[model samples]
Target: MFKYLKNDLPASIVVFFVALPLCLGIALASGAPLFSGLIAGIVGGIVVGALSGSQIGVSGPAAGLAAIVLTAIGALGSYENFLVAVVLGGVIQVIFGVLKAGVIGYYFPSSVIKGMLTGIGIIIILKQIPHFFGYDADPEGDFAFTQVDGENTFSEILNSFKQISLGSTLVAVIGLAILILWEKVLSKKAKIFQLIQGPLVAVVFGIIFYIMFGSTDTFAIKTENLVSVPIPEDASSFLAQFSFPNFEVITRGDVLLTAFTIALVASLETLLCVEATDKLDPQKRVTPTNRELFAQGTGNIISGMIGGLPITQVIVRSSANIQSGGKTKMSAIIHGFFLLISVILIPRLLNKIPLSVLASILLLVGYKLAKPSTFKAMYAAGWKQFVPFIVTIVGIVMTDLLVGIGLGLGVGIVVILYKSYQNSHFLHIEDKSNGVHKIKMTLAEEVTFFNKGAILKELDSLPKDTHLTLDVRKTRYLDNDILEILDDFREKAKQRQIHITLLSERGEVENPDSYIEFFRLRPKTA
Candidate 1:
């Protein structure tokens, strides 16, 4: 892991800057104590990173779970009671891993996965636009279409224009400029520039810019628009920030239900991120999904014990790490250390950095994930892939992550069924040999009940006095419904004065009486 220290160190710093505000903002959105987010970030980074099989995936408190945490806390009657749920949730996740539930991730289509990445990319860009212009009404980490401030996504963008902070806009522009310069030109010029990432430089610039113009009337960036880390007064006070779970209430009904909910949601989110991060990985390495579940479960357990929000493998931080050229999990581990140390030591300094700078960084990350090229590529892959891909993107933008994926997956299944119906059998008609219509129908490799409609329609349309060869020699599996359809077609064939020949690997039959009996007597051979 240490072999790529130079690469990991710089990437870790970039991920640290990206994760800090998200940790605080997600906590704020969840209505949890702000410190809880940091604790989750710390634990997710260190514990999960060390245990995980993914080389580049980063774990932390997720914005996706903010609403759940909010309701769970209220329903459970106390924040400490909610912590009990989180711990139990971790146990459930571990059980899911042992049961190999992680295989569920593989069941998702590639179109849906790509749609997820693109949808998230679009959400990040839309959500950060307000922050980019210095409108701070919405929390940085909230990814929902509907805002807690009683405003929707587009309305917030309109509001941002009315509430723009000149200083923030100026700082954001400069920060973005520096980032682009470093990425497009400087990093390519020297190893030193690569060792010191552009985001670090931009953040440093943002702090200096704030200190210089934060007091000015026309260009002042307010304290509200900056990164806010909880400041502890002394050693004893700092230690007081940690909250222990109330295990006494673990057996309560509400607690158990909340635990199960958290486990299911967190496991699903982690598996999705694992898939997305693996797609984004430059090395194209596959992450062990079940192992990732175990790692995340372990992280959540530790996080909840110390009063942290539930943890999951978050795509934003993971993408930031990958884009920053992270080579290994060392970057994630080091970022956790950074989170731990900064909150403890230099939180005051951290508070000086502008949120606009971080927003600028995320804008770049979002653009990369939802690049126009990806859309074109998906379109070129054909409607089967494009329909689900587009639907997923729209669903995610209009709703949330999971909902969008579900919508896309549904569309993808429909596309599969339609294709199956169309491809059930291939018809080849010989040109009226000897003045009698001759047709040959070859069944597909697997004919399920969904194929029954197409087969029935073809059989119904057969010409009178036709010689039909129904070939099933190549078919490996035939549904019972299709066999019944064929048996009924035999009577129709006799009424139409059509001669029917059944061709299979077993033998040839003249108008087979019972298709089911024939298949039962001569079962599929290996």
Candidate 2:
């Protein structure tokens, strides 16, 4: 881990900048204290990173759980009660890992996985647009369809723009320009730029820009739009930010429901992040899913204990880590340390950075995830892959992440069934001597009810005066529906003057009394 310090250090700084806004934004979206997000980020990075078996995965407060957290807080009647659920949710996840349930992640089709990553990328880009323009009405990085403020995503952006802070916008543009130049041009210089990451440079510029414009009376950019780091004059004041869960609420029915909701959502988000991070990994190392679950669960427990929001493996920070050249788990670990140290020592300095600048950094991360190449590649894979991929995208866009994935999975299953049905039986025709056409039908190993349609279609397509050979040598089991179809086909073949031959272990039957009787013969040897 230490060998790649040159690369990992710079990447950690970039990931740190990317994670800052998201931590605060997710907290705001969750209806939790803004500091809770930072707490989660810190714990996710340090604790989860230390325990996780993934080389590239990064953990933090997730946007996917914002709705659940918000709802849980209201339903439980207190944020403190919800913290109890968050901790319990972590414990449940650990149990799930111990039970080895992580193997379920392997069952998702490759096309669906790609679709998920691409869909999320698109969401990030669309969701961050308002923030990039210095809009803060819905927080800096909320990705849900409906925000905590009860405004729709697009509407919030419009409203935010009407009250746009020129200072923040100007800083954002400069910060974005610096980031672009650093990546496209400056990084190529091979010395200064490579050592100092673009995000770090952008953050520095943001602070400078804020300081320069902050004192201008005519600028009219409110300090509320800037980074709101809690300033603690002493240790006791700093400790005030930490809130413990109300143990009295632990036995409540609402608390249990909230716990289940958090567990389910956080586990899913962590799985998604693990998959996405693996894809982004340049080395393409596969993460241990069960271990990842355990790590995330531990992180959530620690975070909740410290008045933090529930944690999960977050894609935005992980992607930034990869794009910025993170090479090991050290980068993730160091980023968490930065979060901890900065909040403690340099919060006043951190407070000088504008939210719009951080938004610009995330905008780039979002664009990379939702690049046009992703769509083009999915389309090139053909409709069987593309259809589900597009369905998932549209579903996620129209609704929410989980609902969209469910829709995509449903479509994917249908596609699988259609393919299976079409390939369930094979048909071939040969011209034989004496003007007789020999038709051969080979059934698949296992034929279910879905195979009925294909069998019927093939039998109906046979021409008159054809000699049909039905081969069941490889078939292990045939559905009753298929047997009935064969019986009907036999009667039709007789009417069309088609000669039918059935091959089974019992013997070859030139003319069978019934399909059921024909299939009652001894099973064929492999």
Candidate 3:
């Protein structure tokens, strides 16, 4: 791991810059203390990073959970009560890991996974636009389509132009340009560029720009527009930021319900990020999902114990790490240390860095994830893959992240059922017998109720004086629904003067009296 320090150290710094605004913004959005988010970020990085089996996955206070945290805080009556729920949620997640529920992450459709990453990428770009122009009504980390401030995403973008600050716009443009140059050109040209990422350079330039032209009224970027880290006045003030849980709320029904909700959501978000991060991993290293859950659980417990918000594996920081060439979990651990050190020793200095520069950094990350090439590539993979992928992207962009993924998963499941229905049976027409059609319907292995429609249709299409051979010889399991269909079809065949022959491993049974009885009487297979 130390060998990758040259890579991990720099990547950690980039992730640190990316994480700062998000930590504060998410806390503000959650209606929690601004420092709570920072605490979660710190614990996620240091604790989860240490325990997680994931090489590239980074944990933090997720924007995905902000709404839940916001609601739960109010619903539980106090933030202290909510902290109790967070701790319980952590315990629940540990149980989930123990039970190996993380295997569910493997079942997410590839198209949906790709769609989610693309959706998040798109969200990042759209969300950052207002910040890029220094319209700060919406915080830097809010990713919802409709803002809590009652402004919609497009409205904010349009408004940004009207409220654009000269200092922020200028700094953002320069910072973005520097990032692009460093990533696309300089990094390829030299190792130093790789060692010192573009995000760091952009941050330095933003600080310089803020100090230079920020005083002019026409160009000044206000304090509200910049990154706000709750600067602790002294040691006592810093200690006061940490909130202990109200253990009396532990037995409350609402608290338990909230705990379960947090566990379910946080675990799901973490699993999704684990899958996504592994896919984005250039080395293609698969993370141990169960271990990841355990790590996140531990982090959440610690975070809750100290007044921090819930933690999850975050795509934004995870992708930032990957993009910055992070080779190991060392980067995640180091980033946590940076958060601790910076907030403790140089928060005032951190407070000076402009939000526009951070927005520029995220813009680069977003572009890389939502590149036109990615869309084209998904489209090129064919409609089956592309449809869900596109739907997921659109869903996420238009709705919330989890809702969008649910939509994508719904589409994917429909596709699967459609394919299963189409593949249920094979049809072959041997109508060469002078006006008497001979249709051979071969059931697919493991035929289910989904195949009933196709079977019924095939039986209905049989012409008069036809010989129908319904073959299930290779089938292992035939659904009772199909048996009922076959029984009803036999009576119809009788009316049409069609001879029905049922063939299976048990040999031919022509015009059997009761299809259900015959199948039920047969010995059940293992």
Candidate 4:
């Protein structure tokens, strides 16, 4: 980890800049105190990063859980009460890790995972459009189908256009331009360009723009649009922000339900982020999923206990971490430290940063995730891969993340079953010396219940009076459904005057009188 300092340090700074606005935005969206999100980011980075087995995975407050957190808080009647559920959620995730349930991440098909990333990328871009224009009615944090403010995603975009702030819009445009030039032009010029990240450059320019515009009396742009970092004059003042959970609410049934919701969603999100991070790693290192779960769970437990929002392996921060040249876990750890130090030392300085600048950074991140090349590449792979990929993309775009994945998984399963049925057997007819037609049916390596229909159809369609050979040597296992098919075929063989030969591991049997009795007979001694 230390060996990656040169790369990781720079990457940590980039991730720090990317994470700051999101931390505040998500907290604002959840209706939680603004400081809670920062607390989660700090804990997610330092605590989770220290414990996690992943080299590239980064943890922080997640937008995916914003809806749940909002509802849970309202249902529980107090923010402190909601914290109890978060702690319990962490404990439950630890249990999941102990049970080795993290393998669930592996079951997701590659197409669906890619589709998920692309969908999230598109959603991020759409959600940030309002913030870029300085429209702040909805929480900058929510990314779900329905927002805390009761507006749908499209409605928010339409509303943004109507209430756009000219000053904020101008700043956003300039910030975006700077980021683009830094990435496409400046970053390629020399070694220094490669060393400094585009986000840092945009952020610096953003502060300058804010100061220049802030002094003007004619500008309609409000200073509130800039990042608002809580300024604590002393240690006690800073500690005043901390809030503890009301453990008295622990016995409530609603509290338990909320805990389960957080645990399930947070665990799933963390697993997906881990998988995505592994894919992004230049070295292609595999993370220990169970360990990741344990780390996230521990981080959440600590974060929730101290007034922080729940933490998970967030893809936005992780993606930014990777794109900025983060090489190891150290980058993640250092970013958390940066979060901690920034809030304590120079929060006013942080407040000078503009949301539009951060929006510009996120726009770049979002574009990278849903690039046109991604779609073209998926299409080039063929329809089998592209269909589910597109389905997932559309589903996520129209609905939310989990729902879209469910739809994609349903389609993916159908594709798998269809392929299985198609490859279940080999059917051919041979004419023998005596003009007898020999029909051969070779079963697949493992015949399951899914293959029942295909095998039955092939057996029933065999020409009458033909000599049939059923080969089971290559088959390692036969499901009961296929076994029953063989039994029925044996019964019909005699009536159709068909000579049936059953071939097994032992040897060939000229006539299998009863399918059940044929299996009962032992092999003859050599």
lDDT: which candidate is best?
A: 1
Clashing pairs in 4: none
Off by over 4 Å in 4: 215-220, 432-436, 514-526
> For model 1, what is the error of residue 397's alpha carbon versus the real structure, in angstroms, after optimal superposition?
0.9
- Residues 244-332 of candidate 4 have per-residue lDDT tens digits of 99999898999999999999999998887788778778899999999999998999999999999999998889988888888899999
Rank order by lDDT, top first? Answer: 1, 3, 4, 2
Which candidate leads in TM-score?
1
lDDT of 2 by residue, 158-258 (tens): 78678777777887788889989999998998888898988888888888776777669755456766787678899998999998988888888888888
The local distance difference test score of model 1 is 0.93
Per-model tally of clashing residue pairs: 0, 0, 0, 0
Question: In model 4, what is the error at residue 525, expressed in angstroms?
Answer: 20
Q: Which tens-of-lDDT digit does each residue in 348-418 have in candidate 1?
A: 99999999999999999999999999999999999999999999999999999989999999999999999
lDDT of 3 at 327: 96
Cα lDDT for residue 64, model 4? 81
Cα displacement (Å) at residue 381, model 4? 1.7
Q: Which lDDT tens digits does candidate 3 get at residues 439-484?
A: 8989888889987777777778777898889888888888999888
